[model samples]
Target: MDIDRRTLLGATAMPFVPSVLSAAVSADDWGSIAREYDVTREIIQLEHGNWGMMPRPVLQAYRAMIERVNRDTSYYARRGMAGDLEGVRAQVADAMGVAIEEIVLTRNATEAMKALILQYNRLQSGDAVLYADLDYDSMQASMQALATTRGVRVMKMALPEPATRQNLLDAYRMAFDADPGIRMVLLTHVSHRTGLVLPVAEIATMARQRGIDAIVDAAHSVGQLDFRLPELRADFIGMNLHKWIGAPLGVGALYIRKDRIDAIDPDPAEDPARTDIDARVHTGTPDYAAQLTVPAALAFQAAIGGSRREARLKQLRDRWVRPLRDMPQVQILTPDDPAMYGAITSFRLRGRTSHDENVELARTLLERHGIFTVHRDGLASGSCVRVTPALATQESELDRLVEAIRELAS
Candidate 1:
């Protein structure tokens, strides 16, 4: 099973080469596209928000990389690894419509974000940092760490339930106006808990006008939604490839706007000359095979097309959620606005707020109905079970989820 780097580069470069099964599927058939993944049929998986399952092509590429690296060992590491990584980074940049110099590959979004959060040097004493409760828990802890280690004030607010575009924008407006000392706001492009897509470009523009900086946590949005870097208008962004891009696990990226790179002080441990976007965050040797497979992942995603994948994911979400819309006992957390959501959504059963209650609901869904989902906490309203449908999710599986929710809620 050993594959050399040369073979991998040559094979993935020809993006037209479809996986064996997919080669027979016509352009109009999405079911054939769904067959690319070796998904299990024993249980209906609706919790794809946590981690994406790689398609057969990407997985094969990963295996090939593993074999190549394992066989070549340090010889490959010393010579070919750097160029391969740069190729992967270039693929990431191309996929996002950004320049290669502005992006760097990291182990995951959490690592990328913490690097920016910890290295940012612009915050002064008495300056406040703001983030919503919906931001990633690790990122919130990093913000809190800044409060203790740097002596800056930390502020957090809950996004409005049933969020609308204007209300979401206005909330940030008032928060900035109310606290003139607020120097930075951490905006989650899509809430993992509720799947609410905030108006990031509007919020970023407003923050810029107010002399505030924003670091976007776009861990869930980039691959799920079709957008470019300029659309967000944020100088600093941390995103994950593993979640939506179908990249192998342990691969993600960080973007520091070319002009704004200096705002994040260079890593003190690195050489002063290496002071560009790549120098801002340092994670010791990552899973190189996983990183090398990014190009193949990006290529696979491109073959499917971003808009088509996004549309399919949303269609799956709607298939499950639309049926339960009128269920009195079910409280759908995501708003109805198309602009506000993608594949992720959450539903709370009436009177289910406690940790145990939410966990039980998720457990029952799996144990009784063969549908898998996750329970999420940290909302102002209450706890909920989050359902995230991947592109490969079948209509029958979604219908099964709808039936399960209907029975459980009723």
Candidate 2:
């Protein structure tokens, strides 16, 4: 029997049965898996980095939870919701390989990261914090804000354009050596601008040796990459469930090592005396339905298996990227190294680095080819258009994207 969206959604409750596939599933098997997602037919969607779409089963579960929450209303919120949310939190913690006491739920990664950045208590006057161009824009702003709030100096550097795992590590090591006053550093596990995966664990370990705390922004890495949260070796980390986890929008998580909880100040509204992980971010009244549907999303992801999912995503990425790697007119920002990239990759036309040029390039792909992509700025080298393939994206659609790039480059 062929598995399809209807078949999955027909289940009375969300199914937790794992559908473990071999390292590389066959095309027909992938096609059957793709059928589990009901994507729009209007445009070829290669822009899933913003957020992930819930598979049909997860969506059905989300709708059911929404209705249930709406019907039960305050009675449920005031009575059993707390306990239910704790169960959800436990599931998330277990998946992240952390204790429940070390993780807390938040609206999104930005909220969790903002709380970590703003509430971090170790900085003093003249202390310096380091971040690179690849960091998220909002996070960069928050790091810069420390200059005013904490009387710390904010230092920004640009990662090497053609980055390598060793050079990337050396860059941070050298930066730390140059500036001993650096008290904290912000690390983006995967670059949103160019889809470059940093050597986060190595750099975090380097920072720790120098007595500098590292705060990792893992918004794009958690579910997309097959790694445990502890692997990054950071004391604090923030991640999004909505992006790669395929959870409903408005779900994210914050992780703080139990021993380092005191490093982060409690939320202003939270009582200082009660400074547990939960007190770190006080996001009052989140989307309860979305939070409740997390288990369904996890079950859906688990069924696919993390290693298999990562392989599939990277396979999709390489389909287009490998073909264009040597094209004279195209500049692929990410290197060929497997460790430095994942599903997301960005490319630039040799001479088109301006913001408007890249924007127009993305526009041409959408308007002319019926393909959707996004233009990202903030890389020191220049602007580029990012192509991100979701689990549901067809190989034929990526082939179309490759053809479009070839024609455009010509």
Q: Rate the local accuracy (lDDT) of all candidates.
A: 0.86, 0.89
- Backbone clashes in candidate 1 total 0
lDDT of 2: 0.89
lDDT tens per residue, model 1, 1-410: 23344668553343434644345343546777778788888898888998899988789888888888898888988987787678778878888888999999888999889988877889988999999989989999999999877789999998887789999998999999999999999999989998999999999999999999999999999899889877899999999999999888998899998989988877777775766888887788899889888887887787777787778888888998888898889889888888899999998898778878999999999999999999999888878999998877889999998888888887
lDDT of 2 by residue, 264-334 (tens): 99998899988699999998888988998888888778777789888888999999999998899999999
C-alpha positional error of residue 267 in candidate 1 after TM-score superposition, expressed in Å? 2.6
- The residue-level lDDT of candidate 1 at 329 comes to 92
Q: What's the TM-score of every candidate structure? A: 0.95, 0.95
